[model samples]
Target: MTLTAADVPLKRPTVLVADDEVALTDSIAVWLSDSYRVRTAYDGHEALREFGPSVDIVLLDRHMPGLSGEHVMARLNEMSANPQAALLTATSTDDFRSEVDELGFDAYLTKPISKTELLGVVSDLAAAASESAQH
Candidate 1:
């Protein structure tokens, strides 16, 4: 049977999650799956490969094996027009406060992040994106 546009599922906002920690990436993907179309990548290169213009938010690990999260963020910024970036790091915020601001991330999240915080950030990013579009 041919499906019409109304028969197709809605296209949710896409979120690219990049982290070296396999378990962490999986967990975050699960949490975000309900609200967003999550794309998971184990390393920076993989993340960069999967990133696209439709991605609404980027949850990136600060210290990956090859390209660091910071590096990936830089590349994403260059490729996409002002994508929302959230840095995931084990280090204290003080360690990267200056760097985060310089990199233009929308949020800074430390490791062991709670699902609530994760969802909140994604919600905020989505809201911001919606607002931007309306302007």
Candidate 2:
């Protein structure tokens, strides 16, 4: 039986990791590379340059030099096919709940984020995207 593209499983989610923390961003790309098409940007401007319709989700920091994460998120929301986004910030949940709620992010993850937690959310979104694509 020849296995074609159709026989393969779901498409890997293309995730944009946008954070000013170089180490954290690189580590996440390394961790998720095998399971996802991961992209990284050191700051908001770079993230905006790299982001496009192909990206399925964005893991964005709440603060960064030049354009801030919230600004980037707002711009992204303006795109016709906006990608799902999550706030990956060090800000306390209580501190940012109202702000995040206003932005309508797919998730809000505080910093020192565990690999398990990251993977869990990504996997869930990936599965949901795949399911939706099938219909």
Q: Which candidate achieves the best lDDT against the true structure?
A: 1
Q: Estimate each model's TM-score.
A: 0.88, 0.87
Clashing pairs in 1: none
Q: After superposition, how far is residue 55 of candidate 1 from its true place, in Å?
A: 0.5
* Alpha-carbon runs more than 4 Å astray in model 2: 1-7, 131-135
lDDT of 1 by residue, 70-130 (tens): 8998887686557778899898889668977788888888889999999998889888876
User: On a 0 to 1 TM-score scale, where does candidate 2 land against the true structure?
Assistant: 0.87
Model 1 worst lDDT run, 10 consecutive residues: 76-85
Residue 56 lDDT in candidate 2: 85
